[model samples]
Target: EGDGAHGGFPADGVHRTSRLTAPPPVPPRSRLPRPRRGPLAIVVAVLLVLGVGTGVWYINSGQFTKVPPLLSKTEAQARDRLDEAGLDVGKVKHAYSDTVERGKVISTDPGVGDRIRKNDSVSLTVSDGPDTVKLPDVSGYRLDKARELLEDEGLEPGMVTKAFSGEVAKGFVISSKPGSGTTVRAGSAVALVVSKGSPVDVPDVTGDDPEDAKAELAEAGLKVRIADERVNSEYDSGQVARQTPDPGGRAAEGDTVTLTLSKGPRMIEVPDVVGDSVDDAKRKLEDAGFNVDEDRGLLGLFGDTVEKQSVDGGDTAPEGSTIKITIR
Candidate 1:
């Protein structure tokens, strides 16, 4: 064939080769738009499922029991009973009561014959019995006043006994058995010791030997002593010359009486203090070795002058003697 062509085609001009190329690949699935589950949608679906489960549990988990009457039962017993019945112990309150004993159950919250859910706490109210009060100090107070004091302390007066007491006045309380500042239950009895008038009476015992005199005075409920200074008297020496209050005189029991034994004479001349002012009379008698005592009559009370003397002027007596003067 000729090398030239009319359509300008190379016709086996030089041994040239043409090869076919591959087409473009398909797009990946990851590059296209995709459906999504956001945080809000996920949360809402989870909550809905949880709510349905909770409602089912709430409707089916209810188990109830009747609260048995725990009235008057001890706290331990009540707690044990409640626990056995699948219940819990709630608030425990205390109150004072007159009818119920102490440390006992008085009442209950939610009451008796009420239905309560299992593991529910039941309230308990316990009693403390009657209230307590401090024992008052009624010593030295009059009986009537002491009763009032006991009443004020919310206590009851127990026993009243009468006794003679030198320290406590008549018609007054000497002491209480439990004493003061003691705490006791309300309406508790308190034993009392009340005073009754004077103590005792003293008898006469004079002119006896010192030892013998003491014995006699002891029998008569009186105390005896010997004077420091002896005197000369008609009685024999070493014998009691005279005793205080003379003889057959009234003296308080256990009162000491001084016995002046004879040791020759030691007489003193009495001084006249009558018709003088009380101050002047006392001074004059004391200067003359005499003890001055006074007695004011009903009409002569608060008087400043002495009206009469126990011993007249110029009379003889013991050097140290008591001279009573009536004031007017």
Candidate 2:
């Protein structure tokens, strides 16, 4: 009976220990107080949502726009369109165009339907209709003055031709190609016809006495001027050596003719070439300021030696006189 009692006591002790070691019952989860969402709180929440949406929209679409169709629109109209598209007007340029009307938009920088940032600038090319000007009347104007007028009118001066005109003074414009008051493209070259005053035949005065030459030129209704310097020529000293506009060239009636007087032929020593080769003799004579004339007799047709010379060695003759050499 004692054993049974001891065993029962141990069993009871184990039961108690089990009860002590058991975990405590979990308390009911306390519920947070129901948030009292007032009008202000609701509005704040709504604003936060809206801000996020706006940020997304701005990043994706709000910051960008497309260029509008602006071709052929007037500048004022284009500006208005750009403003409506939330864009700024950039550089405005003008260019000549044959197809586009004047003062209208010829093209745009970004082009129509091109994507660009909102408020970005767009360049515009405005049209200035076909560049043209009326041909000006420059007749009777001096050549230099006429050219200036052409440039001022946006035209280029072209080929110039001269003709004798009794009415038009020398060095003056007679007329212009395409005539006056004709509409032509800007920068078009305009040819001009200049006048050479009533023509006068220049008289031949070379080899004549200076006074006689001057009187003869004056009788042709021309003025005469003597040159300040004299030149060596075939003419005798104190005679007119040359006249210009020379004998055949025509000149204006009142034009001046300049006469150069001669100082007579220059004397030079003849070179000795009698025993030299034909080529050597010719070279030596020419180097001495004398022209060489070959006299190859039948016997000397193929000969290379110079057998004789017209002028003897050590003699003096006109510098330009011909030196005849006989080859044998």
| Clashes by residue pair, model 2 | none
Model 1, 27-97: lDDT tens digits are: 77676677698999999999999999988876766466778889899999999989998999999999998
What lDDT does candidate 2 reach at residue 14? Answer: 52
The Cα error of candidate 2 at residue 307, in Å, is: 11
- Computed on alpha carbons, the lDDT of every model, listed in order, comes to 0.82, 0.92
The candidate maximizing TM-score is: 2
Off by over 4 Å in 1: 1-65, 69-91, 97-104, 110-121, 127-130, 200-328
Give the least accurate 10-residue stretch of model 1, judged by summed lDDT: 197-206
TM-score of every candidate relative to the true structure: 0.36, 0.55
Q: How many backbone collisions does model 2 have?
A: 0
The root-mean-square deviation over C-alpha atoms between each candidate and the true structure, in angstroms, is 14.4, 12.7
* Local error of candidate 2 at residue 116 (angstroms): 12
- Give the top-scoring candidate (lDDT): 2
Deviation in Å, model 2, residue 212 alpha carbon? 1.9
